[model samples]
Target: MQLVTWNTQWCCGLDGVVSPQRIVQHARALADFDVLCLQEIAVHYPALEGNAGHDQVALLRALLPGYQVFFGAAVDEWTPDGQRQRFGNLIATRLPVLQLQHHPLPYPADAGVRSMPRMCTVATVRDPGLGAVRVMTTHLEFYSKRQRMAQARALRVLHAQACAHAVAPPEASGDGSPFQSKAHTPHAVLCGDFNFEPHEPEHAAICAPAGADDSEGAPLGMRLWDSWRLLHAAAPQPPTFRLYDRRYGPEPGSCDFVFVSDSLKGRVQRFVVDAATQASDHQPVAVSIA
Candidate 1:
C-alpha cells in the first residue's frame, strides 16, 4: 500500500497562489498513492493568504474522482455573515472505507500563546495488502507547548484504545443498526504535522511505549514506530518544514512525521520526501508498505 501525507498550507503555495489543482497534480507526481492524508485544509477562510474562501474539500473531491474525501475541522466557527468556516485535516483514498471517526483533541487553556482547536481524522479502510487498517491524520497546536503535549498524549491514548478494541472486538452483530460490526485491525498509519521537532517531548509522548502502566487489564498495546527511522537508521531526518521558506525560522527542522504501529513497522518498504516542491511551505512525504 502506498500512502502520502502533506501539510498543504490551505493550498497556498510559496508562489502566493492558492490552487488545489497544483496540489493534486504535485501529489500525483510524487507517487501513485492509494491514500493521501493532508493537514491545514481550509473552508470559507478567505482571510488566509491567497485563499479565496473556496471549499477545499469540494475542490479536492472534484479533483480526485475515484477517491472518498473525509475532513475533520479543528476550528469550526461562524462568521458575521452567518457562513460557517472550517480549518483542519483531510484524508482522501481510493480504498474501501469501513468506518470513520473524528476526534477533537485536547485544547488546554494557554494564557498568553495563540492557539486553536485541534482534531484527528481516522479512517478504517480495507487495503489490498494490509487489510483493515486505520489511517489517522492530525495537526497539533503549534504555538503552545502545554497544549501540544496534552494533545500528543491524547493521541497516544486514542491509539491505545483502538488497539485494545482490535484485540477484543465486540460481538458480531448484523442488525443493520449503528451497532453493526465493522472491520477492525490494530495496524495503523498515523501521519501529519505534529508541530514539534524530533527531540521534543511531544514526539516522545507520541512514540512512547503503550500500556506500560495500565490500570485496566487490557492487552498490551502496540507502540508506534517512526517510518523514517525504520528505513534510514543513522542519517538525520530530512527537513519537512521550513526548508525553502525561512519565514518561520532560520533553521529548517523536521516537524512532520509518518508513524506506523509495531505490527506494520516491518512492512515499511520505502520512505521518501519531496524536498524540491514549493507547492506549500512544508514538503510532502510518502511511504510504501509491503
Candidate 2:
C-alpha cells in the first residue's frame, strides 16, 4: 500500500494561488497513493491568504471520486455572522474503512504564544497487504513547546490504549447494539506535520518505550519507529517544510514525518520525500508497505 502525507497550506501554492486542483495534481504526480493525509485544511476561513472561504473538505471530496474523505476539525468555531469555521486535518483513502475516531489533542494554555486547537484523526482500514491497520493523521501546536510536548505524550498514551484493546477486545454483543464488535489492530501508521524537528524531545517522546504510564500493561514492546530511519538507515530525513519557502526559517529541516509502529516496521518497503515540489510550503512524504 502507498500512502502520502502533506501539509497543504490550505491548498495555496507559493505563487499565492489557492487551488485544490493543483494540490491534487501534485500529489498524484508524486505517486499513485492509496491513502492521502493532509493537514492545515481550511473551511470558511477567507481571512487566510488567497483563501475564499472555500469548503476544502467538499472540494477535496468532489475532486477525488470513489475515495472516502474524512475530516477532523480541531479549531471549530462560529464567525460573527454565524458561519462555522473549521481548520484541521483530512484523510482521503480508497481502502475499506472499518472504524474511525476523531481525537481532540491537549490544548494547554501558553501565555503570549499563538496556538490553535489540534486533533488527530484515526481510521482503521482493511489493507490488501497488511490486514487491519490504523492510519492516523494529525497536526500539533506549532508555536508552543509546552503544549506540543503534552500533545506528544498524549499520543503515546492513546497508542498504548489502542494496543491494549487490540490485545483484549471488548465483549462481543450479538445484538445489533453500540457495543458490538469492531475492527481493532495494533498495527498503525502515524503520519502528519508534527511541527517538531527530529532531534526535539517531542519526537523522542513518541518513540520512547512504553512504561508505567500504561496501566493495562499491554506488551506493545517498543514504541513507533520513524519509517524514514527504518529504510534510510544513517541518512537524515530530507526537509519537508521551508524548503521552497524560507519565511518560516532560514535553515531547511523536516518537521513532517511518517512513523510506523514496531509491528509494521519490517513491512516498511519505501520512504521518500518529494523535495522538488513547490505545491505548498511543505513537501509531500510517501511511504510504501508490502
lDDT of each: 0.91, 0.89
Q: Candidate 1: where is the Cα deviation over 4 Å?
A: 213-218
Model 2: ten consecutive residues of lowest lDDT: 211-220
lDDT per residue (tens digit) for residues 1-290 in model 1: 89999999999999999998999998999999999999999999999999659899999999999999999999999999899999999999999999999999998899989999999999999998788989999999889999999999888888887888888889999999998997778898999999998888898898888886483223665788889989988688999998999998999999889999978999999999999999999999999987
Backbone clash pairs for candidate 1 read: none
**Highest lDDT among the candidates is held by which one?**
1
Residue 64 lDDT, candidate 2, scale 0-100? 97
Q: Please, what is the TM-score per model?
A: 0.97, 0.97
User: What is residue 208's positional error in candidate 1, in angstroms?
Assistant: 0.8
